[model samples]
Target: MALRIRNHIPGLTAALTILSLAAVFAAVLGVIPQSSLPRAPEPLIELIPHINAIISTIAVMTILLGVRFIRHGSVRRHRAMMLTSVGLFIMFLILYLYKVILKGPAEFLGPDVIYQYIYMPTLAVHILLAIVCIPLLYYVALIALSRPIEAIYESRHKIVGRVAASLWLISFVLGNVVYVMLYVVY
Candidate 1:
């Protein structure tokens, strides 16, 4: 079973990535009716963005630590950190989906000039990176989880992991910036 899964990493990654992105889009697009979703309490709804911000921050830290661990040849620590980051990412996504499904996306209350010239562009790039990171992250993660450390180095894991980590870090940073713009600066 493990061998079968290991051999189909690419197909599995593509399928999982597509399904994950589709679910996210469905929530964002309101294809899942807000009426059908149970409402989170007002306080939780309001707090989710803030909670996501903290999660993103922690995820950023873990990704950095994971990279540092790998660079230092500490495979176990790196794996732990990377898996923790993935867990944080899942938690963040669930909260974000809940908020979006219940109340929709947060409105920008910042000035029109900043919103147009800075915030929008930043957000666009952040979102694009996030979408791109999904497949790359999934690919690298699947490879890592399926293979031993020695075997991973012989595969595309290093190349893909580097790209995934870089973009993942950038995405988390930009997400935090977006949160500040929406919740704090405004």
Candidate 2:
């Protein structure tokens, strides 16, 4: 059954994306009871934001390297880099969800004008772009994995990949900015 589903790349990608999004939404909404979740030590909870920020920074660099490799026609290297980026992103998400579940959302401590006009809008856009990138990244990844390199060029991979990469990069950058604003500046 797993093998059959694996052969059906589109279906598998869709399933994975749906499941990932559902998990993220559930975490954000605190749908899971706090009593059911294990508590992280205060020290570990305190370290989560810094760790996630570093993961985001590494993901951005990995993505940039993946783009460079693909542009230079290094398909294997590009694939490795992209997979690394995805793994790093997953790590970031897990840590973030854990922190949010344990500590709840961070309160922005900046002034009203900055919070309302600058931070809020930037955070909103970052979240929106991250949401938009999920299915797109999955689709492109499925295409690359299920088909031959040559076949990917014939599909919508390039177009979708470009859009996904751009959005993912911007989202990560904006996330780092949000982290700084919440943790450092404010």
Candidate 3:
């Protein structure tokens, strides 16, 4: 069964990644009509950024723990942690898109110097890594889901997983940093 799906992984990964990226861009760019979606309460909409910040923080910890677990040969624990991280990532994305589609991206209240020198650069790198991560993450996760633990070792899981995890951690951490710069800082 897993072997059958193995052959189609690349196709599946590409299709899903493209669709995911498209939906994200559509939402962010306002191509997705806000009137088409049900609206959340004002408070819930406002709380999404903070909620996603906490989710991103948890995802960072989970990615680190997942890597540590795998290194220590605790594959079951590692799988659990990694899957948890993915779940958190999904939750964060849904909440974020909802807010962005309804309310638009958050504005930075900091000074121009910080916005130009720090915020823009940080956001650019974070968005870049996040876009890069989508395919890598989908590949590794699909490989893991379609294969048994023993077979996963034979696939490109380790190499891809390492890259995905590294970029994923950096992306999530930078997301939290962006959150702070927007919501907490001047």
Candidate 4:
């Protein structure tokens, strides 16, 4: 059973990456009608950003811990931390999509120059990195799950994991910044 799952990792990763990207695109494009979905109470809707920011912060810590565990040669701990980070990310995504579907994207209320030059660019980079990170993350995760620790060391897992971790960390930080800009700053 493990061998079968291991053999299908690449295909599973690809399919998941595609589906994830498609879901994000659909949400961003507002292809899913907000009116059709059940709306959260106003209080819950208002709280989503704060919850997502907290989730992102936790994910950052988890990723950092995952890296530290790997550095200390604790493969099991590293795997656990990384998996926790992934789970947190999924939770963040679901909450984010639910909020967006219910409330739509928050408009920037800052000055035009700041919005155009700083906020928009930061958001764009954050989004691009996030989109790229999804597949890299899935690939690394699949590799780690499918192979023995020793076998993973012999594979591209290290290289890909490093890239994925870096991008994911940055994305989470930037996401927090975005939240602040949307909900706190402006």
Candidate number with greatest lDDT: 3
Writing each residue's lDDT as its tens digit, candidate 3 over 1-186 gives 777778899998999899999999999999999998999889989999999999999999999999999999999999999999999999999999999899888888899999999999999999999999999989998999898889998989999999999999999999999999999886
Give the 10-residue window scoring lowest on summed lDDT in candidate 2: 1-10
What's the candidate order when arranged by decreasing lDDT?
A: 3, 1, 4, 2
The TM-score-based order of candidates, best leading, equals 3, 1, 4, 2
What is the alpha-carbon RMSD of candidate 3 to the true structure? 0.9
Whole-structure CA lDDT of model 2: 0.90
Candidate 2 has what TM-score?
0.93
The CA lDDT at 78 in model 2 is 94
lDDT of 2 by residue, 150-175 (tens): 77888888999999999999999999
Q: All models: lDDT?
A: 0.93, 0.90, 0.94, 0.91
Residue clash pairs of candidate 2? none
Badly placed stretches (over 4 Å) of model 2 are 1-7
The better candidate by TM-score, 1 or 2, is 1
- Model 4 stretches with alpha carbons more than 4 Å out: none
Worst 10 residues of 1 by lDDT: 32-41
lDDT per residue for candidate 1 within 5-89, as digits (tens), equals 7899989999999999998999988888889878868997899999999999999999999999999999999999999999999
lDDT winner between 1 and 3, please give it.
Answer: 3
